[model samples]
Target: METRDFELLIGRNIIEKYRADRHRPAVFALAGLEWDLLDEVWPPTYSPGGELFAGRIPFDRMSSFLEMGCGTGIMSVLAARAGVERVLGLDINPAAVRNTELNARRHAVADRVTARESDLYSAVGPDERFDGIYWNPPFLNAPEDSVDTSIWDETMFDPEYAKLRRFLAEGRELLTPRGKAYLWFGEALGNPALVADLAEETGYDLGVLAKTEMAEIPEALADAFPADLVGGDSEDGEDAAWHLHLLELRPRQA
Candidate 1:
């Protein structure tokens, strides 16, 4: 798709909630080039996670970045759009990888952005290190047996804490010196102890950036997700909310 069409496809949805204050087009700074990317509604099939992931990674000065489970490659493309020297996006889905590549081309960042089909870290070489890494694991209120294991399984259905543990084990090698790996997770799975313990064991200093008490069902995704799983007092504050934590993880050697 052309850059204009691609930008129009995703920008529209983002503007509704994100750019309500701004009357002009929603501008996205990509790889040193500021583009009028958000002026229209989003694509028909865009997932709910697109805006959430994009909102987490600030437009900071970073030479290299890696986006794990980059559906549609939006986050990776946005990173490239932010002037990051290199942006690598990995996903297990073929269609997602293809869409990522298409978005990269549409944004004129194909030369700098890469989206590939592989598990986390499997697609890159050992020497490949990134200055910034951003990921939003799949954390919904479901068990492993009840849920299908997708890239988002890290957050949604990690009953045994296997996925988080694996990432902690190898995170050191993937991050460069002074680099930071930002992870968006929630306490809904009832595994904060496990998460903290694994981080401590791996010599990572974990920190929570922000915790939003979001309603289990946002009316948009309510029909798709089971309501029983999200039956909590979101409005009353006593209800269980999916705590979004931006963990700042660093390697032991660093």
Candidate 2:
């Protein structure tokens, strides 16, 4: 599929799903833990990315952690439960911040997990640092002139990759000397080349930690786009199901 067509189809599907399910609050279990998702907060039940990333976090290696764009504090709470000493979850959406707080308290990790409304690193203290930082960013490049009119829109779109650029640049300053940062990106749904370019430009070496296939596209979405376009062998002969990439970012070796 053409890039524009693919983006439009994905955007439409995201909006439709959000509209259909935004007001519903529910509890979901992932990796042996329960998370309470609030209305308007992105739900892990809809996308497996959060659970996937949370499971891969090296909690044993980190004393302090920061989770950017923490929708419902799933990873933050899990990290604390796994014995990370301190976990801070940040989100630009007020609803998400509150949802994270709710889940933190729900899991009895309220003392260890802190949620704040922040646009990337804006709310992070300059003198504070974390042993690990991670984000499942709004990776889609929204069409020009697009304005985020809703929290769902902010969750799904990042116009011109602006937020991503800042994330890579600013997040570096908040990491301890031995700390590492991770980004969970969907190669099929995001611009990977741009991600590489931004990582290099921001003085980081980007590498893959792990990856998994999405496996099945929703029947509704499959019908909207060409069958071959949505999922099939890629130009490199790799299955398109292998889309979600858990990427690792480290400071460039001097």
Candidate 3:
């Protein structure tokens, strides 16, 4: 299946899921923050990773927050509402930024929650730093020019893993001395070796902070990854379920 069609199918699935639960608003509450997600933004249906990430956040204390790829701004809002000093959300998709800003307004955190259009940290100032950074990056590695990039595809597939690696490398620069960065990761995305090497070379230590099993796998995802890496169900039954994890990455000691 072509990437365009695959992404369209995923979009359709999200719409259908939303319709099924139309009676209940797409509102998620965690860490004392309630998020009202827009239907047009990245659907948070199969997004347990977001909740897991939010749960790991330190609610008792305040810190600056930076969320890359902040879809609908829920994470940023959660941080702001949790009393984080300041929060900024960045995304490549303009609609995501708009949705984030709107959500921030609705949540009455507009003063502290700022949303902007950026690919990675391009829009961030060189001197800026944060006490906390959050990312649930596009995990699938897509071939260059293999698919017509759509919002759905762009949110799900990381072409050549270039952006993922770049984030792993450069994100450290924006972290304060006592700051920590969190990334939601999955075993199905790519070779574990690739992630391991990147973490090592980037001078970060990757540690699992939380984990959740994936309940459903979209068809488009299957096509994007090889059979062996697409799902956690292997013949050996050793790893029967794919797990989504919140990874804590801290700078390695020299």
Candidate 4:
């Protein structure tokens, strides 16, 4: 699908809509591949804000890597281009897992990268580890409407910020000493301070790589970026939610 086909989410709210042609199939362009993903749930696109944050990090050559929460496999493809020998993209959703696999083939990196349906590190071998890792965790803090169904957050809905904290804690075991992790975070939920605390509590060194304020949303994506994703935007005569912060992470080895 064309970039114009994607929509936006604006204002500070828990959930929004992506009125794209859901039936046409979902695809994302990453590192040259426009791989088709299962859109039974919404598929993620690289927005200007997200891309800008992603562009800031100076990824270094690494022996092997892992990308948790690899939605649409966009970041994973970028890691592959950065010269990682092998990369594993892991997520909890089956649809996302399938999408990631297709995207890897689209970039002709299927052999170099793999996608797995895993709840955190459940599927990973206890002995498995990595030199470098990348993650764009679900960092939004919004109250869920009901605990009934955990809607796929590909569209950036507000849910308890549980996944990120868990990753910060458990991800340490997966890192190889001298290893580094490239983590991108959207500060819509006011998470900079919280992330810092988590980093310290988890015993990892923190580094702020890139950050930008949520200025304005495009006409199209006014409903996709989600108010909770970009600090909320109002139509007129009022201010929207304000947010900003993005960065990478390192596993402390002292």
TM-score of each: 0.69, 0.89, 0.79, 0.75
Tens digits of per-residue lDDT, candidate 1, 96-123, equal: 6776787788788999998888766788
Distance (Å) between predicted and true CA of 3, model 2?
1.2
Please tell me which model should have the higher lDDT, number 2 or number 3.
Answer: 2
Task: State each model's C-alpha RMSD to the native.
Answer: 10.3, 2.6, 4.8, 6.6
Residue 24's lDDT within candidate 2 is 52
Which should have the higher TM-score, number 2 or number 4? 2
After superposition, which runs of candidate 1 have C-alpha atoms over 4 Å from their true positions?
A: 1-59, 140-156, 224-230, 234-240, 252-254
Q: How close is candidate 1 to the true structure, as a TM-score?
A: 0.69
lDDT: the better of candidates 1 and 3: 3
**Positional deviation of residue 99's Cα in model 3 after best superposition, in angstroms:** 1.0
For model 2, what is the error of residue 11's alpha carbon versus the real structure, in angstroms, after optimal superposition? 1.4
Per-residue alpha-carbon lDDT of model 4 for 161-226, expressed as tens digits?
A: 566677777878887886776666655434667778888888888887766655665454455553
Which candidate has the top score in lDDT?
2
Q: Rank the candidates by lDDT, best first.
A: 2, 3, 4, 1
Error of 2 at 170 (Å): 0.6
**lDDT (0-100) at residue 107 of candidate 1?**
81
Q: Return the clash pairs for model 2, or none.
A: none
Tell me model 1's lDDT, rounded to 2 decimals: 0.60
Better of 3 and 4 by TM-score: 3
